[model samples]
Target: MSESVVADFVGHFFAAGVRGEPPTGRIVLSQRRLVLAADEVKETIPLSSVFDVKVGQVPAEMEGYFNDTITIAYRVDDERRVAAVEGSDTNIDRFGTVLFKVLLNGTTALVRHPARLGGRVTDADAEKASLKLEHGSLTFKRKSGPFTVDLGTVISVERADRDLGNGPHPVVTFRHIEDGTAATSEVGIDSARKTNLLGRYIRLRYADVQEELADVSLDEEELEVLVALYSAGEGVSLSAVVDIDPQPLTLLLNGLAEKGIVVDTETGTKLTAKGRVVVGQRLESVNT
Candidate 1:
């Protein structure tokens, strides 16, 4: 094991299948191994054994304090195991972020913290993603919130065309699965190489099939219209999409209604859930 210290987070580690109480272990990540030490009952897991890590809030409890959960799943002796730990929401997150980057460093160039490779994130409102990429996951953090994703379960990553109205910004989408369904996030890519390479890497690594497309196909105009409706998120005026000529735009919008991607609401036009999924590829194509 490498002697260099990376990140060490102290917390109560709830080991899987253990007969006794949860151990107060310091989750330590060195160059080679991830160690959980509580008193003398230390369990050292090789980094290569790590398969995935899931981080999320675990139903806030007690009127006073609550913490997030970090679930680490690994393969051992051809058997899979899981351990979940809870701590200061912030520290628990560091546990996942640092460990993931270190493991991925073996395959990619992410030695220093990734804040330098700045990226923009659009979640409700546009912000910075303090983005960090690991071999098997990616994390986004900001003053408002933090998000962590397991790339192994990621289904798709794609670069979106620039929207002149929005800005000449190159966007990238990262879609992953939860509860057996797919979800996606859109973020701005400052570096062309980073966006394309990350997409190719995640898709090649996780997706079961080699092809990137679903069955549906749309021309540039059709795709653009759907993308517009998705951007509205709720019912909005058709003119918001494009009014190059009201006659042609209305004709196309109504055409999409037949496809069930859009509906003529009293307020204006809005995208149906199905339309958001299939046609919104204009939006993460919009999502499920």
Candidate 2:
């Protein structure tokens, strides 16, 4: 309660035995806890005790009553409990973001935004930034602005090396799409523990996106074409690269295009951003 407040909002808190009548109250989020105070009720949930925080969804028990909601799952005295709060869409989203940062505060990293673009290394300067993770995004908060990477648009994340102020350090590099162009960013966490934690969370989200493509099967030839386009960048001759006839390569490209994996551009046939994600996973699996 004494810690600095991260976010404060007027919202509705849902608890058991309320029978669709939740309490309208002040929702307070601090560095260490979340406090919901109403006229007749006050509930405090410690940040450390929270095991999961979900945004844009309410528990089944509290559904229909609230649409824009954040559900907090925590434990108290060895008992698991769930609480839901309803607020404006923006406030609910802000609460989820703030909660994620509060739980992982003090995680600093050297960030290079647009470290690479379209398979080419960039000259962007590396700077110190605070890390903030959400379900769909990874953000680096710098004085200039927050550089956010949309997980849905991510093509690949890999371990790499970068010189961040000192000597060469291990860093997590992400390749994704920005403004319809392939882009990359790098983050060198200050410690091993922080790097591992951040990587784990990011890969979990990446896995979810990968899972959605599970049903789309690709044969060896198709896979070859994808990998070729990924490696060759744009203006790749699919027929020559895959050792297939031009007619068959046209069919293959059409198939991939239909699957939303590749597209023809002004330069040539290229892997769509999603196509890069697909090939990146396949390549990672092969390399490891």
Candidate 3:
């Protein structure tokens, strides 16, 4: 099979031995290796050699010249070496994300899509998939089709031990938004290193989403109203569900709407996408 190109960009490549101005080159990333081609020299680094990838941070030796950088640490000929790439701030950030995924590409896993939906267990069966990681998302390519989860919409990720035909082992279960509804997925990687690394990366990214939600505070009554709306779905009398009066329930729903958590449709009030994410987080927190 031919190696697929993962990413290609024009950036300045810097190495420890290079003096003065670094070489401006076209950086091409493939499934097996990375190639940097400049005017006179071309350097190829195998992806397997890459041990660490650092984003948004310039190495000490490469500092003072560039701001946004992606430093790649690898071993060549059994000797440790480092190379830095500099580009536009956004490009550097995006390339770093792609590079990180490329390093974890082709991981094998058993995937279960829609393992749960809105507190209800789903009937989907787990199947083997080839993991494909991308910027802000990861894909599970199964025999039937491909299923992807956007990390930005992820609410919670937890580690558990489960038996999937084989003996009980570590698995990762995460809750995310699918078609504007809360859903859960489970994955069991073939190797320990890849599994834990994938889990840690997802949690780190989810932490950013949690930070944005930090300023969003809800009182007990408000939370009760939100949960009621989430569970009972739309067009129901939320006041009856939560044992609150119509007047107070209306006020609570209005407050939630203002916070972009709930929406009042023509027929009834419903939880918005953000509302589902919040409720999903709450449910996962309670379950775990």
**Best-fitting candidate, scored by TM-score:** 3
Q: Which should have the higher lDDT, number 2 or number 3?
A: 3
- Each candidate's number of clashing pairs is 5, 0, 0
Model 1: residue 140 alpha-carbon error in angstroms: 18
Q: Model 2, stretches more than 4 Å misplaced?
A: 1-40, 45-107, 110-128, 132-135, 139-150, 153-204
Model 3: per-residue Cα lDDT over 1-288, one tens digit each: 168887888989886456777889888888788887788667778877776666656878667777778787777987988888887877777777777787777888888887889789988888899988776788999997998887877988899987655778899888898865678898998676567667766775677567767878998777777777877865677766888877877787888888888887887888775677787777677777
Clashes of 2: 0
How many Å off is the CA of 143 in candidate 1?
36
* C-alpha TM-score for every candidate: 0.41, 0.55, 0.67
Ranking by lDDT: 3, 2, 1
lDDT of 3: 0.79
lDDT of 1 by residue, 20-127 (tens): 556677887787787777875777777667766655534222112224676666778978876666667778666666665665432321111111111323235455
Q: Top lDDT: which candidate number?
A: 3
Query: For residues 1-288, what per-residue lDDT tens digits would candidate 2 score against the true structure?
Result: 678898999999975334567889999999889888888778889877776666566788777678878787777887988889988878887776677777666677888888877667888889889877766787789988987887877767788777866789988887776765567788887775456556655665676677767867899888978888776755556566667888888988999999988888878887665776777666656856
Sorted on TM-score, highest at the top, how do the candidates line up? Answer: 3, 2, 1
In model 1, the runs with Cα more than 4 Å from the true position are: 57-67, 106-288
